[model samples]
Target: MDIKAVQSSYARWAPVYDKTFGAITNVGRRCAVEYINSRGGSVLEVGVGTGLSLEQYKPDMHVTGIDFSAEMLQKARDKVQALELSQVEELRKMDARTLDFPDNHFDTIAAMHVLSVVPEPEKVMAEIARVCKPGGKVVITNHFERKQGVIASLERLFAPFANTIGWHSDFEIETVLQEDALTLEEQRALPPLGMMTFLVLGKSGG
Candidate 1:
């Protein structure tokens, strides 16, 4: 996926994002946050669109969120300020592929519903692995393209519309696994006919 394409698509979607895309992604976000809350540490949330999941985090946990879309980030910022969400350490307007944070910064990093929308997803994964503390966990929630069946065919057909849709319908699981620093710890399927996947990856060392 291209960065500009992602940006433009999000810009258009930003107005109705909460009622639309945000609702659809709620299940994965909830599951990811519940798991993170149990771990309870410094967290970095990549692609924190509209801050829909911000209020659900534990009040004591420090959460830093980053998103590539300025418009989307603005909505997130508004939510934080309006709700006085002190748990949100920051809501940054930044790119995922080249995170500005120092290496090994966050104790737990999350990439919920974001991997498929980013350009050079491998680079984004590398950044996630880099800023994550060794032995830390990275939680990911996204729709991975299926291998067969009618859904797979539809995904392939919609592959060309990624630029317009803002995410890859045919995104593969392997794209985000290229970062060698992380090892898959667990995997599971989420709601709505199990279209979305939840993956728990651990940074290789302590």
Candidate 2:
């Protein structure tokens, strides 16, 4: 997929993406934030679309968000401003594959619905792990192609159209994450939503 094209597409869809995908995403965000809080840490959220998850974050936790779309960042900026959280939240236009923070920088890094859309999942995960303190947590939630059954067939069938619109790779996230030594702490599917996976992973030998 073309990075520029994907960015442009998201920029165009920024206004409606949240409303269209909010139902499931709202649950995903809550889940991600809860997991992060459970681990207790300074947090970073990648691909924070319209800042829907901002409210889910506890006020005591400091957070930084990064996304590639300016328009989407604009919406998120507006949201942070509206909520009077400008001092606590920082949203930047950035690529997940190449995070700007220093090594072992954050205690928790959340990537909600971000990996599947990126061209380099492994690189992004590596960057995520690099900035996380040892034993720190990495939370990821993304739409995936079910291993089997009717849903998988539908995903395969419409993949062409979906690919053109915004969707990217739908490969097994478990296999991908494991390859980079990010141990899966927990994995569960969100009920009634078979296409997505909510996962909590920890750094190896942390």
- lDDT values of the candidates? 0.94, 0.78
Error (Å) of candidate 1 at residue 144 is: 0.3
Instruction: Score residue 130 of candidate 1 by CA lDDT.
Output: 94
lDDT of 1 by residue, 60-155 (tens): 999999999999999999999999999999988898999999999998999999999999998999999999999899999999999999999999
* Model 1 bad stretches (over 4 Å): none
Best by lDDT: 1
- Please provide TM-scores, in order, for all candidate models, with all chains considered together: 0.98, 0.92
Which pairs clash in model 2?
A: none
lDDT of 2 at 67: 90
Scanning candidate 1 in windows of ten residues, the lowest lDDT window is 175-184
Q: What is residue 52's positional error in candidate 1, in angstroms?
A: 0.6
lDDT of 2 by residue, 1-206 (tens): 45787687787788898778666567777888888877665888988878888867777888899999889889988888888873345888898888999998888889988787776778888889899888888898888777688777877776665446776534666544754657788888875555667898887656
Please report the TM-score between candidate 1 and the true structure. 0.98
Candidate 1: give the clashing pairs: none
Candidate 2: stretches off by over 4 Å: none
RMSD of 2: 1.8
